[model samples]
Target: MGALALVSAVGLAVDDRILVGVPIWAKPFKFSVSFVAYSLSLAWMLSLLPRGRRAGWWAGTVIAVASAVEMALITLQVVRGTQSHFNRATPFDDTVFQIMGGTVVVLWLGALVVSLLLLRARILDRAMAWTVRLSSLIALAGAAVGFLMVRPTPEQLATDDSPIVGAHGVGVPDGGPSMPVTGWATTGGDLRVAHFFGMHALQLLPLVLLVLAALAARSVRHPRFPLLARLADERVRLRLALTASAVYAAVFVLLTWQALRGQALSAPDGATLAGAGAIVLLGAAATTLSLRTPLP
Candidate 1:
């Protein structure tokens, strides 16, 4: 599951066109990898259920079906062209993808709600249950925001003011003049912010919990006074703290590099770096002060 999620994460973060003659509307390999990963992950989660009716198979089946439908909708959209604007007369294939992709999300939400109810009533104590539930809830919140931002009105593709938001492609020439076909990409939807927050919750939430777990382990490994006689035992907490700090540092640096590539670094990036530096320094100081015994 971790490996699959990691592959999906890479795909979601980077866009690569591996297939030729693919429509621009189609998602690149990155998106496809993430989609496939999510599908497989969901199936694995279902596999964890005990044999027989110990778990609510009905609810699980519904959730699984919804998940599959969601994937299929996305797949269809990538393979088949979808019309951006409904007001404009569109071909049959175009509207089909729109309905499938949009409506399947609603079904997914319904399935999620049912699954959550089942979890709270009968499965909350299970290992990793809370993490799955919290992650799904966070994702659902982001999905809600995205759905609300969508335009219900039919779109006007010909007009400069599009009824549909987030449409990007080539623009036609105005008046009777003929000009070369130029691509014009629009980014007003604020979709990226929501997606960035939502998709990453899987990583962010787990990392948060891992940090907390590390802190707990630190306290257990070293009480008020260190075990001077047993150097290995004495330094366990410090080791755990350092390990966690290193992982945090590496992920932050990767993020910084990404921000640089996009030229999106600014005061916020600087502030984050400063905050991370403070954390590492404080952790180091605490570890050092707790272990200063002249190597007894």
Candidate 2:
């Protein structure tokens, strides 16, 4: 599935087409690559659970189908030279939009179920268990952000000619002064920033833990290693993972808050700066304390 998505992304990237002031192919291209990465990460994490292979297969199947459907609809729209999301321009378009929305909801629910399963299971590695639980929850929160995009803001309803459902940008309309490749809003609040960060937690948390595990393994075999091995103990690593997850969650919340308040990512004011600084300091302190404390 990942390979297929990658191929689709490459194909779309090479295609010469434009729609609504941006490359129409770029939407599916980006989504394809994201889906590939997401699917691979999810599969790897699910592998950690006992008797999870079957469960993973079921969950992965559902997600893959839903994601493929979504990409197909978006790509179809691109081929037709029309908008895929929040477009109720016509009855047919509205139906397609509804299908896409429904498919995404299913995908989100499937993910939630997998997360619950992981949480309920009694895994041996405490740090990995916690990492899976926290990352899944964070990813779900990110998925929930899509709801905000689905519900039309008052500004969108008043301004757009079509029956507006939702938008990506806040303060300014969508498609205004976006960042380079990702096209996230630079001059206005873009919910995608939060969504992107939140969804990738699954990959980030586990990857960090894996690196710690590797370092710990290396230190055990090689006593001359400079870094203290005590910090690499399972308990300390668990504490560190928990602290990191908390910090990750804080950042997600801050981004969501900033977007809701119509603040641009690149143009955070004094309050935003102060709030972000405080969070960073707290994260640093927690990490330092976790590293210093001796395991009982």
On residues 10-107, what C-alpha lDDT tens digit does candidate 1 reach at each position? 64456443322233333433344544544444444444444434344565565456545544555454444433322223445456546655655754
Q: Give lDDT tens digits, candidate 2, residues 1-296.
A: 45545655675668667665577777877787788778888887677778666876788789889998998898788879888999888999999999999999999988987888788878898988999899999999998998888767777667757565678887767778878788888888889889989999988988988888988888888878746585568899899899989999999999998988888888898888988999999999998888888567
lDDT of 1: 0.42
lDDT of each: 0.42, 0.84
**How well does candidate 1 score on lDDT at residue 182?**
18
TM-scores for all candidates? 0.46, 0.93
Which is the leading candidate under lDDT? 2
Clashing pairs in 2: 152-165
* Clash totals in order: 0, 1
Candidate 2 lDDT (Cα, whole model)? 0.84
Model 2: residue 162 alpha-carbon error in angstroms: 2.3
**How well does candidate 1 match the true structure in TM-score terms?**
0.46
